[model samples]
Target: MRQTKIVVTSVEDDNFCKCRFCDKKIAEIKNDIMVPSAEECYKNGNVPVPNFGWFCSQACAVNYETKFDINFAKTKEGKIDYYL
Candidate 1:
């Protein structure tokens, strides 16, 4: 017989929340509404990520995605574009 150990971490335990785009603390609510959820972090993103993603707006989400992936919002001016 064998025994295995596993560990899990989540952002829900954190005392402070931040904006995924600018890394700013989300201490204020806008018009009584909170920030966007993790599932809406990226442009075409539809899955929940575990790293506490709370974007203030859609533009912030896009900006954050662009920073993570340089080509996330690049144009196909002089590069080969492919669709699959």
Candidate 2:
């Protein structure tokens, strides 16, 4: 039999940090929340994970992505449209 190695993380989300996806307060990682993976995010219209704190929930991430995409649109003539 062989031995296996395990890794542990000390990283903790800032209490004051807000979810980039929803502006909701980020709960402590000690609470054992599930942060969505980048690949998983793409399925919901390419949501972006923050460089720091994560989203409050997966739904918020999806909503955030779609809202961002709504800012732009394609014209009938294949032109890029930007909206405020």
TM-score per candidate, chains pooled: 0.36, 0.35
Q: 40 in model 1: Cα distance from truth in Å? A: 16
Residue-level lDDT tens digits of model 2 in 1-84: 343221213244453334666566443333443333333323333322333334445565546558877422335753322110
Model 1 Cα RMSD, Å? 12.0
lDDT of 1 by residue, 1-84 (tens): 333221212353344445566665643334433344222222232212233345445456566666787333223452211111
Which residue pairs does candidate 1 place in steric collision? none
Error of 2 at 63 (Å): 0.3
lDDT of 1: 0.39
Model 1: CA > 4 A from native: 1-14, 27-52, 70-84
Scored against the true structure, residue 29 in model 2 reaches a CA lDDT of 36
Per-model lDDT: 0.39, 0.40
